[model samples]
Target: MPRKPRTSNISRSDYYDITFYLQHYACFHCRKAFKQSFDNQRTQRLCPQCRQPMTNMGTDFKAPAQKEVAQWRKVQSLAQAGIKFFPQWPDGRPGERPDTLAEIPAFLKQVHPPSEGEQMLERRSQEPQRPQTPREGKLSLQGFAPHQTFRLSGKMLITGDGVQVFHNEGWVNAEVSGHGNNPKQPSHLRTFKLVGNKLYYAETVPLDGTLRLRWPAT
Candidate 1:
């Protein structure tokens, strides 16, 4: 008889250890209740559809956790049978299942709070300040600091009465040289330039072509 081929054996403990490491790599942004070996680990950190980062979250995998997951699945199954998810939580005390995709941002934020740049923005927004009004019917450029970093991109149109009429941030106002109410419209109108900051200037662009000043008259 031909000699039987020797088979390499993998110990159950070894297999379990490998399983634990692959199944739970200290996830920081998402929980992995269950994963199958069929999933390729190399591309695990990105979504297959949108190519977005996938979060790995925290978990305490014990009997109580398993029970919670079981209860959640039971409720989710019931809801799939046309049960309303929120009206008193269609599946008794267990409640509804979260949409994994919808819950990603919350998970990531929890895992990784604001970085230094984002924290700086929060500080700037919270800085104490006062609102300013325009001067001399014409916007006095003196008080308003020029946006030096990025030059303003929009146009300025003055009202016939010498007022910089309507204003909006990052938009330009169209002019017909002097103020004559747009022929077809009840209110005089102007379209804004798509690029500049409108906040420093007194001009404005209404959605329907009419520009009105948002600043207090000087």
Candidate 2:
């Protein structure tokens, strides 16, 4: 019972030079979420089970149970829409997340407006222009300018330069080739070759039934 247990009055931050914050990374496909110390230099985090890139759900994310498919799907949709679970809104209020799948569309619309491609297409449609040739039969590359983005289908968003494809997970390097009528269907299809021998066929027309050809907004 000596005086050997004297406590220091130093603050925690002053004692520990480097503070490490925890961040949650979720793999929706695996229905798993784990925490890792935040590393500013680290760019990508891969799931331990699936080896797929994990979504950074931020510090406030609480993972749903593995059996809760609907809940997981909602979370996945939010992640795909580039929404992260933060503790507080930008205005300092507590975050309010949608509870059901049906409410997600309205919530997303309120938080995130139409994407860049949609706005660009809308603006172009308003402008006076001549009717152009339909791209249903040809493979002309004129519409695909550099740095533009187009929604190839519900599951795929491709860059105009044919360099990358953004799916539910994230953007991946891809090669777009063999543009023409799909052999299996009457619609036009664009072949996309992903990094790991994964081939995807996306319709030239987007899910909204619009074929974007105008330049994207900068």
Q: Model 1, 1-218: lDDT tens per residue?
A: 99999975864323434455333221212222332232334456554345455332212221124335544443333333333222132433323333443454454455457799988998999998654644322222212212111011132433322223344443233432222343212223344344464423334333222233333344
lDDT by residue (tens digit), candidate 2, 89-192:
36643288898777898899888888999889989999998645322211223123332233332223333234332343544333333333322122232435
The Cα local distance difference test for each model comes to: 0.35, 0.57
- Each candidate: how many clashes? 19, 0
Stretches > 4 Å off in candidate 2: 1-19, 89-94, 115-218
Off by over 4 Å in 1: 1-35, 41-113, 135-218
| Best prediction by TM-score | 2
